[model samples]
Target chain A: EAEVAQSPRYKITEKSQAVAFWCDPISGHATLYWYRQILGQGPELLVQFQDESVVDDSQLPKDRFSAERLKGVDSTLKIQPAELGDSAMYLCASRPPGSGIGTGELFFGEGSRLTVL
Target chain B: SQKIEQNSEALNIQEGKTATLTCNYTNYSPAYLQWYRQDPGRGPVFLLLIRENEKEKRKERLKVTFDTTLKQSLFHITASQPADSATYLCALDKGSGNTPLVFGKGTRLSVIA
Candidate 1:
């Protein structure tokens, strides 16, 4: 089965350091999303991409976090000066376009875990 | 602000029994409700999706019911097994037809033999 791909399944870094996570969505999927999952909380949408363009990022902390889907197929999320509270699971998900059968279904990657010391 | 709520407490049940999980939302009504399963250290796996117009949907041993009037959805796993033990999350469309999903904290189920 086609699946979303993520890199650096686990990462640990010191506070005030830089960290990056990568995700490659399933082929032909036009909608991509980046979410953060705290230890005991639900995943929160950090950003949404539609074919290389960002459509929603209101919840993203622009001051220290940045995300980009340069080709619309894969995306990268970066955080500079990581904080202890930033420790969480970074998840990537994709969905087929509006015309596809699974209209609201999302295919998620294994996720990248980040821990700030 | 929109919010989704699931029982933070763990549900302990025996294998072969039925496990039911609940999800409630406030401030916005979703067009569709979805259920996902997640093991530790992994991302969520899609399970079922029920639309606002639909009251029930079933797949294999899994079943889901959406109650729009009550603003809640219930997920059920029948004849559960130890492998069925995991955190179950409920998500909804960003309230629009096509947008990112908003997820709930999820309910943890522990199925014992």
Candidate 2:
């Protein structure tokens, strides 16, 4: 079965340092998403990509956060000058396009947990 | 602002009993509602999807009911077992083709044997 893959299951960084998380979505999926999940809260959309172009990033903290899906298959989310408040679980998910007998369904990865102190 | 609410507290149920979880939303209509299960320190796994036009959907020992008028969805697990203990989340699609889903905080269930 195809599954989204994420790396650095756990990451610890110092404040003002840089951290990056990578995700390889399910093969052939056209849509990818990055979400931030704070403890005791639901996952919040941080960025979304359709193919190689960003579809939505309204919730992303542009000042310090950035994400890229260069070849439209794998993606990376980076945080320059990480802050303590950035500690949380970053999740990646993907889905195919269109609907029908195989209406696209979203699949998630184990996620990368980050801690900045 | 749109919001999804699930019980923040844990729910305890005995094995072999039925476990019912509620999800309520405020503001905005969802194209479809989905249920997912997550074990500790792991990601969510999709379980079922119920569309606004559909009243109910079922699979195996799980059942999902959606009430568009009430802006709510209920997930039920029958013949619950200890293995069924986990956090269950409810998510909603924003209606945009490429938009990501909005997730609820999730309710934790503990099935005691």
Candidate 3:
């Protein structure tokens, strides 16, 4: 079974520093997602990408956070000047094309955990 | 404001018993509902999905039911074991094109052996 891959499984940085996480979705997957999950809470969508194009980013804090799927295969999420409240798990997911439109099941990576001091 | 609620934050059940978790949504009608399992410090893994038109779906010892009229979904695990202990999440999608799934906080289950 093909699986999504994520790097930097754990990261720790001080407030006001920079942090980045990377994800590589399953091959042939056209849609990719980046979500932030706070402790004790559900995951929140930060960005969505469709074939290297952004589909949704309304929930993303553009002022400090940015994400890109340059090749539509792997993606990177960055946060400049991280805040203490930004500590959480950064998850990456992918869906194959024509799977179920908006109803397809997502395959998630192991995730990148971030801690801001 | 759309909201998703799970029945409780934590549940305890004995081994070989059935564990039931509840998910309720308000202010939105979803076309499909999904269940996921998450271990501590890990990302969620999809378990089951039930469509609005479908009443129930099952996979081995796992079962899920979607009720659009009641705006609720029920997730059940039968003959549970200690390995089944984890946080279970319920996610909903509006069924529109290119929409993202909304998730609930999740319910933590501890299946004691």
Best by DockQ: 3
lDDT by residue for model 2 (A1-117), tens: 888999999999999999999999988888899999887677899999998999899999999999999999999999998999999999999987673222445799999999999
DockQ of 1: 0.62
> For every model shown, what is its TM-score relative to the native structure?
0.96, 0.96, 0.97
Give the DockQ (C-alpha) for candidate 3.
0.68
Order of candidate numbers by DockQ, starting with the best: 3, 1, 2
lDDT of 1 by residue, B7-83 (tens): 66589999999999999999977888889999999999999988888999999999999998999999999999999
lDDT tens digits, residues B68-95, model 2?
8989999999999999999999998755
Q: Considering every candidate listed, which one attains the maximal TM-score? A: 3
Question: Which parts of model 2 have CA positions greater than 4 angstroms off?
Answer: A99-102
Ranking the candidates on TM-score from highest down gives 3, 1, 2
Question: Which stretches of model 1 miss by more than 4 angstroms?
Answer: A99-102, B94-97
What would the C-alpha RMSD of candidate 2 be, to one decimal place?
1.6
lDDT of 3: 0.93
lDDT string for model 3 (B36-106, tens) is 99999988999998889999999999999988889899999999999999999999988776578899999
Error of 1 at B92 (Å): 1.3
* Candidate 3 chain A, poorest ten consecutive residues by summed lDDT: A95-104
User: Model 3: residues >4 Å from true position, as ranges?
Assistant: A101-103
Candidate 1 accuracy as lDDT: 0.91
